[model samples]
Target: MTLTKSLLLGTSGALLAVAGAQAADLPSRKAAPVEYVRVCDAYGAGFYWIPGTDTCLKIGGRVRIDTWYTPAKSAVQLRSTGGPAYTGVPGGGTASSTYTSANGIDQLGWYARGLLMMDARTQSGWGTVQTVVTLRLAAQTGLAQAGQLSSVPLAVAGTTGATIEAAYIRFAGFTAGQAASNFTFLPSNQYHSIWSPSFPSGIRQFAYTATFGGGISATVALENMGDLAAATTANSLGFNPYSATAATATAVAPQRLPALVGNVRIDQPWGAAMVSAVVLQNNANFATPGIQAVTNGLGPLVRKTGWAVSAGLRINLPMLATGDSIQAWVSYGVGALNYTAIPNLNANTATTANYTGGFLRGDRDMTIYCVGVGCASYGVEQAAALNIAGVFTHYWTPSLRSNLVGSYIRLTPGSTTRNTDWTNGGLSSATGWSVQTNLIWSPVRNFDIGIELSYARLQQSLTGLNGAAPTAVPCTAAAPMCNASISPSNWTGRMRVERTF
Candidate 1:
C-alpha cells in the first residue's frame, strides 16, 4: 500500500505538471474552428475545395419571338419566299429564279423562337476556360424567311441543334470557334424595320479579344466568307449545284473570308464611345461565277474583294436619368458587293439557254446611320426607324418599330446594254431603295404580334440591248428594253404573331 500510493502520487504529479504546461501554451481563451469549402472553375473565380469532384457549370440564355403585319396595298408580299436578288418569289423553280417580285398569294403569318443555353467551365491558376452551347427552336426555318442564305441549318420544329449563332471555347483573352463577325457596332434597336439588314450579321470564325487598361478592347477573326464564290465556282464546275446558271461561265474564286477588326473605347462621366473597322472578302458577281469564255473558252476570270468600317457612340447624358440615353452609329463599305457570279441573261427568255447576267465593276459601297432614344423598352433597344430608306430604326413604343434602306449598284452590262426591265433588271439605274416598317405589341414577356410594310424602287439608264422598238439609244447590245416587266420597282407586306420561351 505504501509503494502503490507513492507511484500514484508520482503519476498524478506528472499529469498535473503536463496540464499546467499545456494551459500556458494555449491562447488566453478558446479559439473558433475555421471552415473550408471547394469551388469549381465553371462558377468563375473565387473557389474553395469541394468535398469531392473538381468542376463547375453555368447556364443562361434568352428566348424571344417576333411577329408583324402590314397593309395589303404595299408592294411587299407577306407570304413571299426566295433568296438574294430573286427575293419576293413564293416558289422555288428554275424558271421563277429570275423573277424580282414573288408570285405567291398574300397571307397572314407568324414565327417563333425557342432558345436554350448552357456553359460549362473549369478553373486554373492562369484563368478560367468555358464551353458554351445554344439551341434554337422555331416553327419554320427563320433563315428561309429572313432571307439568310447559309448552307447550315439554324432552326427546327421539334429538334435540337447547335446554333450557327455562337458556339465556342473562351479562355484568358482569347475566343475560338464559330463566333460573331467583328464588324458591327450599333447595339440599340427597337424597331422591326424591313431595313434590318444586319439582324444576324455574325459569322462563324476563330477570334481573339484583348483588354487594355481603361475600357478599351480589341478583337480579330478569320471567317468563311460564306464561301459564296467558292460555291458558285463549284456549281459551275459541277462539283456543287448551288451556283447560279448562266450563259457566260465565270470561275468563282475561293474567297478568303478572313476579317481583321478591332475597337477602341473611352468611358467618361458623360458617356461611352467606340470606333471599329473590318475587312472581309465578298463575292463580286451575284449572277453566276466569274465569266471567262465568251466567243472562245479562254481569258482570265477575275474576282473582287470587299470591306466595311463603322463607328458608334452611346451617351448617358448626365442631364438625363440613368434610364434615359442616346445612341448613334454609322457604317460604310467599299467594294462590298463581290457578287462574282455571272448572270443568267437568258433565264426570263423563252429558251433554256443560259446567258451572262452582268459584271460588277468600280466602287460599290453602302452606308448606314441611326439615332435613337428610349427606356423601359421591352426589347431593351435604343432607337427605332420609322419606315424610311437609310433609316435603320424607328420605334415609338416598346412593340413598334420600322426601317428603310436604299442602295445604288453599277455593273458592267454585257454587250454594253441592259437585260431586265422596270425591276432593275439590267445595269440601268441599279439604284434601289426599300422601306420596311413593323408595328408590334408584346402582350407578354415571350409573346408578340406585329405588322410590316415595305416599298422598293429601282431606276436605270439603258445603254444597249434587245428592244423591239429600236432607237438612236443603243439596242440589242445586252441591255433590257423599257418594258413593264423590267421596270425597277417592287413592294411587300406581311402580318404575323409569335411566341418564345
Candidate 2:
C-alpha cells in the first residue's frame, strides 16, 4: 500500500510540473490597456487632451432666441415719402437707431441664432499656439435686426443668414484672420441693451498683441473696413465712416487700405483701463456728384484720412456682490465714427443694418445737399462726433444678475448751412441719449433667461430757416418749416433665452 501511494504521489507531482511548464510556454491573452482621455487643466475648463498628442481641444455651442417690442417715439404720424416735395426722404420717416415709426414696419419682432465653436491649443516654443473657429446660423422675422437711423425698416424680414463669426489663429502673440477689433476698449459683454452697440461678430483683420508684465498689454491691427459693415452700401456714409447715413453718402470709393487700429490696455485685480485709436482712409467715389466728392472743388476725387480715439475704464465692485463691476467709455471721431459705438452699426444687411443711411435720422458723416459738386459751401466736409457710454452690473445672487447701461451721442455736421437747408435737401445737427436695464436669471451654468428694457431719445434738426426742428414733413413752399423732425423718445423691451455649452 505504501509503495502504491508513493507511486501515485510521484506521478501526480510529475504531471503537475509538466502542465506548469506547458502553460508557461503557451501565448498569454491579457486584456488590452485602455487609452483614457485626460483632462487638460492648463487651459480653462471643458478642455481635454487628444489621445497620443499634446494638443488640447474644446468643442462648444450656443443657441439663443429673442423676442422684442419697440414703439415709435413720436405720437404724430408724419406724411409718407411719396409726397410731392419729400421725394428722397424716408417714407413715414424713421426714428431711433433701433426702430422708427415707419409705415408697414413691424413694432415687434423675433430671432433665433445658433453658434458652434471649436478651440484647439498646443504648447509651443513661443508659448501656446491656438486656433478658434465659430460658425453662426441665424433666422429673423418681422423686421428683426433693424437699427436704421431713419424710420424706414430694412428689408431683412423673414431672412436666414449664416456666416463664420470667428475664425482666427494665434501664435507668438500674433493673431491672424477675423477677430475683435483691437480698437475697442470697453468690454463687449454689455451689448444686450438699447444703449450699447449691437453685438458684433468682429472684423476681418490681422493683428498682434503684446503683453507686458502685470496684466498690461498693447495691440495693433489692420481691418478690412470696406467689408466690415455695409460700408460699401450706396449713399450710406456714417461719421463713424461705415456708420454713415445713405442720404449724404452718394459717392464713396471703396476703402483700398485696411484701417489701422491700435490700443494700449492694463488689467488688474481692481479693474481695467484702456485707450484705443484708429486711422482710416476716406476715398471719394469718382461717380459721386460734386457734393459727395472729397473736395467739391475741380480737383479729382481726393482722399482724406479719417481718425478716431477712445478711452475706457472698468472698476470692480466686489464689495457689492460677486462679479459686480462698473465701466465707462468715451470716443471721439473725425470722419471715423465707425470706431465709435454711436449708430449701432449694421455690417450685414441680412442681420441688422442700423448704423447710418436714411435709416439713421440724426447721425451722418457727409452732409450731401444735392447731386452736383456745386452743392453747398462745403459739399464734402468731414464730420466730428462724440460718444459716451457707461454701464453698471450687479449680481443679486449666484443665479440672478442685472445691468444698467446708458449712452449719449452728439454729431457736428461741419458747415452745413446751405447744405442742410430744407430747400438744399440735407440733414443738420443731431443729438441722442439712451438708457437700458437688463435682468437675467441663470439657474444653471451655460443657460440663462433675460429681459432688457430701454428708454431712448434721438433729436435731429433739419434747421427750419431759423435753425431748429421743422414743423412739417417736407417744409412746403408756403410754410417752409423744413422737413419735420421726429424725436422718437420711446421704450423698447426684449426677452431672450440662451443656452451655451
Give lDDT tens digits, candidate 2, residues 217-295. Answer: 9999998876433233222221211212223332345567888999999999999999989888765442223333555
Quick one: best lDDT, which candidate? 2
Computed on alpha carbons, the lDDT of every model, listed in order, comes to: 0.37, 0.61
TM-scores across all candidates?
A: 0.54, 0.78
TM-score of 1: 0.54
**For candidate 1, lDDT tens digit of each residue in 291-380?**
223334422333444555556666663343333455555555443322211111111000000000121111122110111221101110
Stretches of candidate 2 off by over 4 Å are 1-33, 72-103, 154-157, 190-199, 230-252, 288-300, 343-364, 367-379, 417-419, 422-424, 464-485
> What is candidate 2's CA lDDT for residue 219?
92
List all candidate RMSDs to the true structure: 14.4, 6.9
Q: What lDDT is reached at residue 328 by model 2?
A: 92
Off by over 4 Å in 1: 1-55, 61-63, 70-103, 141-163, 188-201, 227-253, 266-271, 282-301, 317-322, 337-425, 429-501
Query: After TM-score superposition, what is the CA distance of residue 173 in candidate 2 from its true location, in Å?
Result: 0.7
Instruction: Show how many residue pairs clash in every candidate, following the order shown.
Output: 72, 24
Reference-based lDDT, residue 52, model 1: 48
